[model samples]
Target: MKFTTATPTGAGPAAQFTGNVWFDVIVAGQEPSRVRVNTVRFAPGAHTFWHRHVLGQTLHVVAGVALVGTRDGVVFEAHPGETVVCPPGEEHWHGATPELFMQHLAIWETDGSDAPETTWLEEVTEEQYSAARTRSA
Candidate 1:
């Protein structure tokens, strides 16, 4: 049994994220494994742009509050210890609430091919963000 000591943190691309976000690769599975895991941290109000996974995605909130929104204007809320899932090819975005920093374990799979696993779309506009918060409130 081989154990990894630690995995380095990766900076989320600015083109795909707003504010500040960081990710640590917890697991990078290969061939037989087929699973990928990332421990992602977002500063208050920081969030990822609209995107969708080829094989779906799951998020387990580790601390603070998480806000996940879909293309249809539904912003699902999750507090610490809560988990959320986005079905395959369902465009969505996730991040920390405006008031608190947040961390979550993002679990997904590698399509195991050359094609990209995620397709990122436009950034969340201020109006859209505000509306979501208001609706959630």
Candidate 2:
């Protein structure tokens, strides 16, 4: 196998993320392969807006702690080496804790058609974020 060309790290769209967040595309398969992988880094207190995947998504924590929350107010706490999965069409958000930076590998698949693979929803409200922060492990 040959090495793939490198691409620059890119910041998440301001419309979909809060604070400073960046990501590197690790792999984006071509036709006959729907796989996509990204290495995402989140600054302390930074996070993604609520969104859902058409084919589902998986996250493998690489460093620090990751907080993943659902519309129902459930927050799943994941630390380095842990893996988290979100089923197709489940609205959710994920990011680092207020005290630490975090990184995770996001893995997902695009639906094999022209339709978008993700549907981004509203931003995470400050109230919801605070509520999640107060949650006990």
Candidate 3:
């Protein structure tokens, strides 16, 4: 068994996220192992852009409240200890609700040999975000 050194928390890029979001890489497997895990923290009202993983993604909420939205305008509210899964190629976005900060561990893997791990698309429009907030209220 071996212990891996911890890396500093990094800010999520503006191109990929909005508001204030940060993440720490928990594990990024070496060659032959495509697994990736990250502990992400989002400030109230912060969120990721529309994106999808090649092999799919799983999110385990760790604190506060999480809001996950799909392309079809369905937003799921998940609290601490809950897990949400997005199937491969299904565009989605996740982050904190407007009232509280949130944290979640995102786990995913690459599809197969020569496959990209993630595909990032456009940002979530204001209309879509507002709709989600209305639904949550």
Candidate 4:
């Protein structure tokens, strides 16, 4: 029953994100636990670069609207209280819409080894970001 220490909010680096973004670590489990959780805030038009998790990732929208896109140009729209999952190794990107600020809890696990848990790729182009989105029911 140990309480986790508070961690400082961090700016999303330009190398991995576009526009303005910030994140606060919620849970970063130690050995024997691989779970990692963070509350991420994105400014309007902010988004992450193309990336994939080694063991998958989960996102729970907390405010505003979220737009998640895949390699196939399909963007899924998620609103507050909705949850979305990206299966292991499925390349994807997520962020706030152009007109709204957004916040979501980003959850994922670290592979038990030294390898990177997320592989970041190229930034999402404007065409990709502006592509039409399919609303989540």
Off by over 4 Å in 2: 133-137
Residue-wise C-alpha lDDT for candidate 4, range 26-62, written one tens digit per residue? 9886878899999999999999999999999999999
What's the best-to-worst order under lDDT?
A: 4, 2, 3, 1
Candidate achieving the largest lDDT: 4
- Name the runs in model 3 displaced over 4 angstroms: 112-114, 132-137
Candidate that scores best on TM-score: 4
Residue 108 in candidate 3 has what lDDT?
96
Error of 3 at 104 (Å): 0.1
* C-alpha TM-score for every candidate: 0.92, 0.94, 0.92, 0.98
Model-by-model lDDT, in order? 0.87, 0.89, 0.88, 0.97
Question: Model 3: which ten-residue window has the lowest total lDDT?
Answer: 128-137
Give the Å shift of residue 31 in candidate 3: 3.0
TM-score for candidate 4, residues paired by index: 0.98
- Which pairs of residues clash in candidate 1, taking residues 3 or more apart in a chain or in different chains? none
